[model samples]
Target: MNLRKISTNLKLPNYALAIAQDYLPSTFFQYDFKTSNQVRPAHTDIPKPNFQEYRRKPLENPNALSSESVDNRRAIMSLFSFVGGIGTLYGCKAHLVQYVLFLSPARDVLATASTSVSITDIPEGKTMIVKWRGKPIFITHRTQQVINTERAVNLADLRHPETDDQRVQRPEWLVIVGICTHLGCVPIPNAGNYPGGYFCPCHGSHFDGSGRTRKGPAPTNMEIPTYKFLDDNTLFIG
Candidate 1:
């Protein structure tokens, strides 16, 4: 219906012109589309219906809850969520603690891991042997004469030289592993060529009172296990 000619003939704003371009009919029609504030005159032959007859009636909802009931439901849901989150956290913590404990050593193995001896049981100038982790540990109760003799020895004469003071925390107590340095053989206490020392009969290795390698095939002194004095009368060895 010559829509372009109609649009070009009419004077309209940019926005209104664009709308007329899209919505304008391809064929001529009787309807008038006005973009102005002026109202169109109503035809006398067409009658208007009463709005009251066409209006919808408001209906009452049978299942609608009050504000108090809605608030109570919301509060209950929030409390349930909080309780569930707290329970999950505690459950994870409990599992983590149980896993950590499962990885640790058994109680009986830990008990046998270290050895404790009463130094008062061993008389002066005597040595006592105890077992630690399936190995013999020598606990010597040195006399004043034995201590003096060990401290007086020359460091140059020993194979693996270590001073008597360096090997012991206290002069009266000498703690060492009883295994021979030459080979894995147990040494006899107070029966070596060096008096007041240990003798390994397996390889003829001699160790002085301080556990230093003397005249033998042994290359180093006897090993000193990890030890500490729990008290004046107790020795703890590991």
Candidate 2:
């Protein structure tokens, strides 16, 4: 058909014919009219991701930690360490102080080697009891008769034999432990079956004016402490 007659019979606009002629291939007019139900392979080209740019970019801050910041952190740790050491030292010192205080009383008691008492406080021919080192001490001011009597005792007859002169530093003063040698009981002065002596009523042990055991179950003489005369009237006993 003539191009104008074909266009009029198809009822297509003149602009549409020109558009189809420019866009379509020359073989499009020679169709065989055969159809197949199969999916065509896609031949589209996709853009690849730029992995090199991602790898090149930095993951961290460009500037590293400053020396000043590191120094500040070290200084803070050192300060904490110093504080802990001081606290530990203070705790140890406090414990030491408490231990010293606990031992102070016993230390004071043991520090001195001697104790003094006035001789005048003990009258002549009387026995006085005093405390030394938490134990009883007997200070006897013996009369001349008592001294003679103690000196006259036979050493063979005594249970615990000791001379009167050996027991006393001076003729008038007799110092010895007041505790009975039998069982550690304190003896009553000048009140026993024996004259010018001490008696332990608990076990019936008797000590003479020289403190030598004379009667009953006592095993030894009363203990004599180390003593000396500081002056005419003051006696030092240890």
lDDT of 1 at 119: 85
TM-score list, all predictions? 0.56, 0.55
Q: lDDT per residue, candidate 1, 1-238, as tens digits?
A: 2444445456556677668658866454334444477867779757866565553232133245455366666777899999999999999999999999999889998999987888888998898889998899999998888899999999888888899999999999999998998879999999877768999999898998899999789899999999999999999887
Q: What tens-digit string does per-residue lDDT give for candidate 2 at 179-219?
A: 99988999999978767789999999988888888888999
Q: All candidates' lDDT scores?
A: 0.84, 0.82
Candidate 2: pairs in clash? none
Q: Between which residue pairs do clashes occur in model 1?
A: none
In model 1, what is the error at residue 16, expressed in angstroms?
60
